[model samples]
Target: MPGKSLSERIADFGRRLAVEAHAAWLAARDPRTPWPARLLALAVAAYALSPIDLVPDFIPVLGWIDDLILVPAGLILVRRLIPRALWSEFHAVAAAASKHPSSRAGMAMVLLAWAAILYIVYWSVRVAPVH
Candidate 1:
């Protein structure tokens, strides 16, 4: 097999991070999970999935701070909180999810949903009764 390009590897890593965050989200809700671990996992997953960032991505070097610093740090903290046995299971699930090809159709659907929402807002503003 040919060696993967740098971009491919980076994309794979990003997928893995998303997968692991999702897995942790699931694990956090389990009854057996410790409260502290659950809290950390939930926070980490929420931060990772949130569209709004602590530092907006358009802000040059500062924009990347949350992504480069906070996320990895949160993931590491969550890992420490999880018990060894459960961590292994979460790792396995994350690894499996990361290996599958991403769905372009799903991406399109999300984009369409956002467009529809924006259009609705625009139309509402245009047609609203004058105050």
Candidate 2:
């Protein structure tokens, strides 16, 4: 890190994020993971692994929020909830990186979620008292 250039540091961060997401996915499926942690981990994995972005990249500021803030926060929370030893084991596995990492179903799930959000917004505007 001390010797790394800005681009190198950014690349390292990206790689670390990918590794953490991979680790979360691996941990979610493990029976050893506690249910609460597993549930959060699964959600994080689905979003991170999915090719489609939940908030589309064309949306400006909101687009990067999930990737930069949400996923990492979710991973941090999950890391705290999971036993350290188990997480360390999965982290190593994720870093070694034997993964296919396709998520077509995750794409469908993201679309549905966006539709539901849009519907809620529409309904709220329709029902609101017009001042």
Candidate 3:
């Protein structure tokens, strides 16, 4: 790190951030996760994974604030909600998984899951019991 250029350090930080976000996603999906923790982790994962930033990078200092602050804060909250042992396991799994090549099948499954969830929500609302 001492001899690394600024860009190299930034790239390293980005990689670590991706690993953390992946870990949160894993924790969110795990059945053993407490309901509150799962909900929070899901929120964090969604926010982190989103391509649109709250403040666009063109905005200079303000844009990086959300990336450097909000995501890490959310990750911290999620880490606290999960038990230490479980979080460590999740982090390890996520780190190992990150080394693997990206999977289109995994992407399709996630999209399918979200579509199913949306359909269920719509169906329930369309048939709500209003006595």
- Model 3, which residues run further than 4 Å from truth? 99-131
Q: Estimate each model's TM-score.
A: 0.65, 0.83, 0.70
lDDT of 2 at 78: 89
Candidate 1, residue 3: the lDDT equals 98
lDDT of 2: 0.89
Q: Write the per-residue lDDT of candidate 1 for residues 1-131, one digit (tens) a residue.
A: 79999999988877767777776776677777899998888777766766556556899999887777778788888888888899888778766763433334334544666678889999999999999
From the highest lDDT down, the ranking of the candidates is 2, 3, 1
Most accurate candidate by lDDT: 2
Better of 1 and 2 by TM-score: 2
Candidate 1 ranges with C-alpha deviation above 4 Å: 1-3, 97-131
Question: Poorest 10 consecutive residues of model 3 by lDDT?
Answer: 98-107
TM-score ranking of the models: 2, 3, 1
Tens digit of per-residue lDDT, candidate 3, span 30-95? 999998999888877776776655556689899899789988999999999999999999899989
Clashing pairs in 1: none
